[model samples]
Target: MELLNLPGNIIETVVRMLVNQRKTEEIKIRRLNFVQCLEDVLNLRATCVRLLEIVNNTRLKFPCVVNFSWKDPELNFDLHCFINFMANDTNWRFETVRFRKTLFHVEETNSGLLSIMQKNASLFAKSVARLNFDLPLGSNSIVLNVLNLLDWLRRESLKAGGQISFCIKDPFFSNWEAVLLVDHLSIRGSLRRQFDIFIHLVGSQKFPNLSQLDLPDIIFPVAKLCLFRNLHALSICNLELPENEHIPLHSTQITALLLSYAELESDEVECFSNVLCQCFPRLVYLSFKNTYRTTFSDDDNLCLPETCTTVETYSHMLFYFKKCQSIRYFNLQDYYPALDRKIFVKQLLTTLGTRTALMSVRFCGKELTRTDFMSAVENIVEECHSLDVLSVDCCLLDTQDSLNDQTEIDLSKIVRGEKILPIDGQESEAMLKLKDLCRDKQLKLLIMGKTVLYKSTADVRLMGEINKLEDLYKWNLKRGCVQWLSLEN
Candidate 1:
């Protein structure tokens, strides 16, 4: 009855049967725990010679989705696992196969994953796209040694007419690799020393292809904006940028800028306005919340009105936004709770006047009009010529009228050129207004978070929009997915 002593074929047969059994509804919940089943397989792989052979025969089959973690130094990936991954069937899911680790194993053998990746460099270089690394500070020294492998993969990927999305989820400037090897880097955590290194790398054009830079922890110095030459998207959440200084950027490739929880000082509004006008001419998507350089209260009700008082602050922000004529989407996420809807409507017209290039307006979990929001819709159609998409989190808007407000949306209908009509007594005034706008603008509407919950799964709607099914499949399959989208219509 010792499983490890069994022959390779026998082990494979048993494992297959067990996997099948665990998948069944009869056994999924009560019969076998998931962790225990995985543990059983891991033990089998480590202790049994047979199971490794079985892995070899199967062409080293790997799931399209990969999520590997290193909890401790003892965990290892042997030669078998590395060889298995090199199987010609290596296609990965574009949903960011994450490799995260905290502790660095210093026994000179190198961490199991690094060893495997190094050993199988040629095989891995040809496969991966969209690599996201979220390693802790302690792993910096170990990661430094593997810089050559990363650089090789990056260089090879570019030569194949493909770009590697190397994401670094921390601020660790151990050397120049922090900026040199990353496409998407989030400057965060214990960044006192790392900050200076980051400035040096960026200021010196270390990573010419770095497209996205996110800073949630540091109140970054305003002068650093000029450092990024190829940045396409920048996100700075909850930090206050100094006002009275007109910071300029060197990159026209910049597209999306998200500062959801940013605090705007009174004097800083004009400075931002100037930057919006002068620095970002090709800006496409912009998101910001109105917070006058102060923190909100713990009480929900008390926090909102204080932020909404800054009507003039938002007006200037909108005025500056006029220079960003190429913008396609705008998002305002719960920054204003109570405001005179008339002023908001007028300001919308004034700022967005005749700039019809916008495609979507997403009010994510924000409070909109309670009564007649349709007033803005008429102006949007007349002025903003190409507006088609309007997504709002209508759950927050409260009205005394017994209008049946929508709770969920069907993405199937939205993509199919069909209209989503409101249910009887369920249609709020805002919904009715949006319906009119959709009719006039010929728009596609979605209730936020309802349509395509994860951005990775957003291909569901686009699949229907594509001219042929085969083409869609061929396209997504390259990224390691097969039938991830439900097509059982």
Candidate 2:
């Protein structure tokens, strides 16, 4: 019998199975074949009115957590229909619900649409364990509607111990008290006035559960530090540190910190380092990333001179490594002048040598020559006893040879000892020595070269880590650096 002649219940079951089957084999050929077959079946839906009605009317149920991003232009089905399907039940669960500006098209607030959205929000509040909701940025009318809907969602989610992450671009919310419900806040203001206004409005208010903050291109909130007693992660990019004011100390709860494109006077670097050691004594992850003046435009006066990031910066930054003694992962990507790469790396290795908890260390710099990197690895092998992983950017080698003809080298073949990469004399010498050191020390060495190279205990571990990184960071083997702490042995 033709599929169109099937009974209504059978057709409904097929439609629901097609929409809700979340598990699939990861093999490329199998994934492609499954996608093609699914596409053909979906296309057949357009030819049959019954199938379309069943798809729109089916009460879909997802067994696993759902991640719905409403702005995807490639979405094959109508999002409004899916939202209605989700709202059909009051117990639909979700992992993340990201609503971007393109998700909505109405110029003015429609009470009917807003009411439907709020119903979905109520369902999300009860079922979603964690909420990383990014508000839609658009016209004032729609923005207000989304904010009000999210406010209701936040209040209900908070009752169930759910966390909310807000990336605020505009500070003109009707209710400032709504911030008290936020658990993670990211302030994205391009202008200084906007940043100041946001701080002025919310800085003094206490957040009982706010634990993660991202303040980019803004000044440090000196007074508000005490308000967030549970802050665990902070990312400050392109921020100017206060010159003479004494930065207060935070509790030993902060574990992850990122300081990128930071501006500070030559004299303040040391004091800031001392303050960080005292503030976050249990720091487990630290990242220091800076680009020298060469990358800055001529009109960019904010670029600190090469002298600002001298040996003093390294000494001061390394002070935290020595004092904390709890760092597990460290990443440094910077261009330095007036400081020898060898000396800088030697000091870093020496400081981390005694850190028994250190698991991964990554270094990225164009100025670091092959010889300098080899020497750094030798020092790490001699010093760091508990270190399990070492990652380095191959751009530091200054080699003109390409390891693979194609853009993607088969990492599975490399891990299986079935592939060999040809290298230049100087590069090969350093890499061979580096590999020998890692092998002897029983460590995993990851080279972010033409492609990534690493030894995995099994093919599953490498594939799993790759998939996880790709899903979270949109990372691939050809990308910049891998977060080794996310790797499983």
Candidate 3:
């Protein structure tokens, strides 16, 4: 056989093809490290060109996740440019580009971004599966950019026969930023027309495929409640209902719900109860932080019957507790007034009674004395048999001083089936009654104080008694505040 001599260009082309074929196969077999490979490719101009061509030709698909690293600016820029190029290339049929980074930097803008996206709208509309946008913590025209990007995507999703998933990152706010986020995203009033157009383009049909959503600190009711029929996990903050306004009770396919700064007024509570009872039959995890400003009023027509009277308000939350039978973890925070706290604890136990599925419970409050705190623990041990992790914090009183004096008062008698006589002061009477109830029930108790001043010898003594009768844990109130307890076992 005669050896055939090949041209230099042809030999070079064949070698390049062999190398890319090996890399592509490695990617397919999961043998190539994506980060290392991308880094190496980015470092070489030749490799970068080859990788870009390979990416364009093969159109690889990847999962989208939120990224928030200031160190990977070059990678972010590269990815953004690549996405824009693919979106603008009418000849390319790339579908399903995973967007990383939930927080978008407003300072990073290219005029070519929109025009390219608009030019390739048809192709993008046909292929994109998940779109993740990051809204960084800056006051720039990021919202407008998001609106423009969304508009283009919406138009494309309409022409295409596939669903799209959208996610946004929200930062904490003290003033109107939260409100602005809501107003910008919510499809209400005359803006409803524009929203309806958007809904038709991307909402009604595409939203059913949404599986995970995260809105860490923004509250937009209209946007939140609209397209979550198939949502599995959601994180939100500052969820509140307006006075005299009624939120319709609707169920979504949500399994985990995390809410912060939730303001559930009397009426909204009822509406929520009705919806939760009937709609979220499969919900398993629910967490909420009730804002400090929430209050109960007798004239509030939407207030549940249990909340109609001052006595009832104490246990009113119980009325809605039974509805969430599938819940495994429950967290409540910043709930106030000693009476409300006591009622809430009692009702929670009664509502969750003997439910073996519960794994954790956390409650934070202010102004709770040692007596009231111990009673709450006993109630939980007696009533909620499934609790594995329990936390309770008193916000107003000193824990150390209170615990020390409290221990000297004889708690083992109370915990070991012995009743204590009531004292004359109103506060003392409440404390004595709680102790008596715990003694009668023979329950384990855990107490925590929120200030170092609260972590005195008295607290240590009280904690000792609690350990004697059952199990007891005490946290120094002053050192770390609320986060220390959260971090502990």
Q: Who wins the TM-score comparison?
A: 2
Candidate 2 C-alpha lDDT tens digits along 1-489: 397788878876876555432212112121112233235345756776777666545544332212233333354245555556456632334434443332433432244434544556654555544444444443565555556656665665434666676666655444555456677887665535665555554455556677888876655644455445578877776434445566555444666666665554455556556555565555544555543322222222222211121111222244333434444444433334344434345555666556532232233343434455456556766566665444333333232222122132332333333323442236545555656666655455454432344556425654454444333322223233222321233
Q: lDDT tens digits, residues 1-489, model 1? A: 486676767777765544333223122122222333343345555665656556434322121222333323234333244345444433211212244443334543255545655554545544454455455553556566446445554554223434444334554465555346567776566665577876786777788878888776666565566778688877776434444454433334566666645565444555555455445556644555554433222221111111111111232235334444444443332223343333335545555544433222322113333233234344554455554333333333233221233233333332333445332222344444444554544333322323321123234554343212122111111111111222111
Q: Choose 1 or 2, whichever is better by lDDT.
A: 2
* Candidate 2 global CA lDDT score: 0.47
388: Cα error in model 1, Å = 2.2
lDDT at 32, model 1: 27
- lDDT by residue (tens digit), candidate 3, 314-336: 12334344544444434333234
Q: Candidates sorted by TM-score, descending order?
A: 2, 1, 3
| Whole-model lDDT per candidate | 0.43, 0.47, 0.40
- TM per candidate comes to 0.53, 0.56, 0.37
TM-score of 2: 0.56
Residue 210 lDDT in model 2? 73
- Give the winner by lDDT: 2 or 3: 2
